[model samples]
Target: MEHLAELDKKHFIHPTSSIQQQQANGPKVIMEKGEGIYLTDINGSEYMDAMSSLWNVNIGHGQDELAEAAAEQMKQLAFSSAFSTFSHEPAIRLAEKIASIAPDGLNAVFFTSGGSESNDSAIKLTRHYWRIQDQPERRKIIGLKRAYHGVAAASTSATGIKEFQEMAGEMMTGFVHTETPYEKTADEAIHDLRQTIETEGPDTVAAVMAEPIQGAGGVLIPPDDYLRQVRALCDEYGILFIADEVITGFGRTGKMFGVENFSITPDLMTFAKGVTSGYLPLGGVIVSDHVHEMLKEKSKGTLFHGFTYSGHPTAAAVGLKNIEIIERDGLVENAREMGGQMLRAFEKVQSELDIVGDVRAKGLLGAVELVQDPATNKRFSPDQQAAPKVIDQLHERGMICRPVSFEGTDIICFAPPLIINREQVHTMVEKLHDAVFAVQKELQVKG
Candidate 1:
């Protein structure tokens, strides 16, 4: 603990962490390793990785085969470029594999370092494709409020969470925002979206981006017909639809992609996170043939958009192998099966808790939202960190679950590894139940 505290206080700069609190109380450091769906800290504490290590780690942790694959690639060709006049076999093979798995008509791939960069690339491609089609005026990209795209400029513009933008002091141009379909009827949400488009005018709108199931936005599962309605709305408005599958891709939602889970195809899809299971940084955009062909044929100039690490060989090799493992191990099928069991467990627990507002689950992804009064459907005040307290208690009880507080609501997200089994799910629920009891006690004491 001495070494951990010293390092965290002196050197570690964490993302989305409260640095002041961290410096005062030190970090929650995991010293050693993980295997399958479990992790052991330096203090010999074993816990379930309930959030799948930030909703990645699809194939779970400590797969020696993955390590060996990465090691062998490093030995043979540690680094290479995929820029013009230079392309690698692994990159080509991975691209082909991605194209095969991606929805029909999305035949082209442009790689990036992670989800953020992939989303950024999608923004650029959307505008670029529109420009090539001689509609440079169609540059307004609409994103749902509370959506989490990424922290980069363009991607952040597509991000609707207020905290990400509050300190930035401003927003990027050409990024329009609409209400998320969460907690709203599909028809009403669609009507509101139509109104937004009318207010902005369709000619000014270029693309509309969404998550099939809002992952970072409190794991909000919309009405069943929402994505289909969004598709129809996009088609009617002549707007390209982009599915941001950063958290839901690669079998997280019990499907290879979230778009498949909802049965709605987008013109473009951005993927990252589980692609390489966070073992390597790899992400990209899958463009429809229409957009791909337009950019290839009608484009007047060079693509002029890419990263120095685009299609990094080592990452591509790892990603290719990752996809293979996901397919071979039948993790997607497992996710679907375990998801049913997990949702039932949550439902049973939900029935016992008066504070439980909503119990939503799809595939391996699920959430249990808290409220002030369930009968009245009254939510707790946004200032109440009820979910965060539960998250902290869960960690103390030897598990990791994300307490999503987007828009000041309490939704505890459960996204375990696809490799998790029924026993692990039971263990996770038991620990979460204990944590919820403890949090309720704490809230009572505070009150």
Candidate 2:
């Protein structure tokens, strides 16, 4: 453990981590193995993977089927470039599978290496689509506040998180952010969206991207009609809607995709993470039939944007097998059931504890907002670090989860593997209860 920690600190810069923290504490936990809904550290300490390792492992930690698929494909043909009209069977078959299962009208795909690349591709492709339609002025891409797309240049610019953009110095032009429906009523939110569109000049806008449910933004769930209204508004203005489903796709949201929960068909949808359950990095933008047709019919030479790993044979094979497992085992339905059970568990804990402000869950994704006083909705000071304290307690108790303290809100987030069962749900909640209780006692003493 010490050897690995020293190497990690000296040579590796972890993604989305505090470098100083790594220097101070080394690696938080050196994971040695993973299976079902749990992971084991190098020292043999087991932990329930409550956050699914950044909410991507929808099917769970270790699945033999995906490994076998990758191996079998690699033995036959490890890779073949899908560039300049070159193609391969794995890419073709996976694209067909994605088209068959994606939301209606989204029947075409352009592959990428992962969510960041997928989102970046979607932005470029949307602008290209408009360019083909002879609207060269349509280049602006608007994303929702608190929405997380990816870490690539375009995706980073499209993200609503201030820290992400600030870290990148100055962001690129043509990216705008608007308030989310979580902060406003559905009607008001739609009005705000329409106003943003009008202000941006509808003729100059290429697409408006959003996460159906804000996952990293504290699991903020909008009203039932919020997305539907947004879809209608976009249609009314002749602008494209892009659902950034990197976290919510592939049965994580109790459906094949998150947009289905709202019954809306985005012009373009970007996905990754659970697409292959993190076994292999693969992601793509599923284009609508009309958009695909227009690009096919009117596009000029070379659509041009692509990744070297795009349509990688092994990753594509693993993605196919991953989807097979998700369907065959009925993990999507399990996420729905387990999600409700988890929500009820959260509510029960909230009822008994005033510090738990609000509990929101959709499918296996959920969050518990921490408050100082629920009746008044008063928040604990930032110095208290209430959510992180509770999360640390959970970690000490052999459960892994995330604490979200974005924009003055303290939230504990969870997105357990879809394979999690009722007993596991109860166990997670029990540990969470104890964790929150322990933290509250510490805070009381400190106060």
Candidate 3:
């Protein structure tokens, strides 16, 4: 184990991690196994996976069903290119199954390796659709501020987070961003979208892409009618609406898709993460019939956008089994019930802890905002590093979650496995409360 840790430190380049910290501390916990909502590290210490391993793993872990499905497909037909009229049953079946469960009219599927590729494909498809319609100038894509798309060129440009865009140098042009609907009524937020569109010239705009609920942007849940209003506006202006469901799809939000929570249909929907419960890499975009038919009738030649592993049979087989388990175990219903329990528990913590500034939740997706002054919602100074400190305390307490510090505020977010039970929810909240209290005590001492 020590030798492996040394090798990881020497050779591995981890994503979204601090290189200095990795070189200094090496790997903190080497996870060995996972079951249900708990993970066992190499040292045999157990931790409640409160963040669901980057907000995927909806069906928990250590399920032999998904493994068996993958092995079965591998033995029969593992590798095949989903290109130039070549097709496979697993891909065909999975696409049909996804369309059956997707929001109305989004009946066509385009597979990708993961969320980033799915989003990137959506961008290219949107632009291609416009070009085919003879409106080649309609190339601009608009996104909500604080929104996370992906790391690809087009996806990064569509992302509203400035840090990501800056990391990649000058982003691809023709992408703009508008204000998020946080703390605003639906009408007010819709007005902001309209203003951006009017300012950008609707003729030049191609699509308005947004998450039904912004996950990485601190679990921001907009007003109830926010998406509906946005859909209406996009329709009115002939702009396509793309719902990035990478984090919210497949029962994470207590619904089949996040858009169902708002009863709005998107022209294009990008999904990943929970499709195979993180057991396998798989993602795709569900194209609305409107867009699909347009491509069918107007396209001159072939659609040139796709990934090599777009329709990997092994991954598709696992996705099929994952969906079956989610349905058979009634995990979606459990997410709704347990999510409510988690929110109520968070509210109780907020009432008890002055450091807890706000608590917001939707289904299993939730966040606990920490602040220096609850009375005025004043955030902790960046130098304090309050969020990471609290998260460190949580790790010591055997609960794993994410510390989100975006837009100058610190928040600890949770997205436990959908199979999590009431008792586990209570335990998670108890540990979170203790962690926050520990941070608060440290702050008081420093003062």
Candidate 4:
């Protein structure tokens, strides 16, 4: 413990980590390695990586091939700037490969370092695109309530979760938020979105940004027709549609892209996280042909928007190889098949546990919602800290799962790697089942 504290104090300033918690309890220092869907700590304790290291490691952990690709790229030419008339082969090839897999009409790519950077770029580029098209007034960006876009100023503004905005002092002006489609019926949600647009004036609305499944927002899965309606509405209002697939890209949701899972295409799509299976940082925005042509024909001089590491050769090479592994290994198809099995496992929990409120799963992504009274669908009081307690119990049992912090409710999200099989799903479920019971016994004692 002393060793761990010394290391964190000297070298780490963690992201999204609670400083108070760290000060009190130190870190869960994971040294050693992982394979397929399991991680072993320094003490030789094994835990199924049920959250896929924050839902990113799609192809699984500790794959030697990814390391080989990185090493090979480093040996050849590790660094190349994509600035002004300079281009690298890996970057060019990655752009082409991404284009081949993107939805129809989305043929252009602009690279960034990660999801936050990609979102930041998208916000700037969307506004720039509209200005070039002579619609500068269309600057209002609409995001769904409970959405998790990113952490930067503009991206956080584009985000719908209030928790990310709590310390920011003020909300971004003209950044509108509406109820998510999952909160109501598809038509009702559409009606509410239309009302928001009407209230704000559609002429001022530049775009509607969304995730097909709200991955960080407690795995809120929209109705099957939600994306279709959203696409139609965006077209009706002439608002650019942006799908934030940072968490759902690269077969996390059993599809190459989460938007593809719903069969709806967007005007712009932002991707990161699973692109290189979290082996390297790479993110980008895919633009539709109309937006692409407009930016090309109207914008003079490089669009004035890019990063120093845009399409970094090393990241691009890793992504190319990662996509190859996914294709060669058939991980996407496996996710679809195993996801069904995992969802079925939830039925046993629902049948046995009185605390279960709802079970939602897709591909390798899922969440089990806990309520005080499952019969009446009444939620547990937020002060009870039920979800965190369950997380602690699961941790003690040597499994790593994340508690969904949105809506102040108890939701345990599960996102194993796409490579996880039925046996691994069973292992995770068994561990979770025991943890849930342990929490229940404690809560009963407290009551």
CA lDDT, every model vs. true structure: 0.87, 0.91, 0.92, 0.88
List residue ranges in candidate 1 displaced over 4 A.
445-447
Model 1, span 1-447: residue lDDT tens: 788788778988889889898888888765488998888888888888998888899999998878888999999887887777488888899999999998888888999999999999999989888887788899898888878899988988888888887758666898878877777788878888889899998998988999888888888888878889999999987899999999999888888898897788899999999999989889999999988888879877567898988988889989999999999999999999999999999998788876778897889999998887878877878776889988889988888889888766899999999998898899888887888878777766776
Measured on C-alpha atoms, candidate 4 has an lDDT of 0.88
Better of 2 and 3 by lDDT: 3
Estimated TM-score for each candidate? 0.97, 0.98, 0.98, 0.97
- Tell me the RMSD of model 2 versus the true structure: 0.9
List the pairs of residues colliding in candidate 1: none
lDDT of 4 by residue, 287-340 (tens): 989998888799987657778999999999999999999989999899889988
* Top candidate when judged by lDDT against the true structure: 3
lDDT of 3 by residue, 253-371 (tens): 89989999999999999998999999999999999998999999998877787789999999999999999999899988989999999999999999999789989899999999999
RMSD, one per candidate, in order = 1.3, 0.9, 1.0, 1.3
Model 1 whole-model lDDT (C-alpha atoms)? 0.87
Model 4, residue 216: what's the lDDT?
83
* Clash tally for model 3: 0
* Model 3 residue 28 lDDT score: 81
- Sort the candidates on lDDT, descending order: 3, 2, 4, 1
Evaluation by lDDT, superior candidate among 1 and 3 = 3
lDDT of 2 by residue, 237-280 (tens): 89999998999999887888998899999999999999999998
**Which pairs of residues clash in candidate 3, taking residues 3 or more apart in a chain or in different chains?**
none
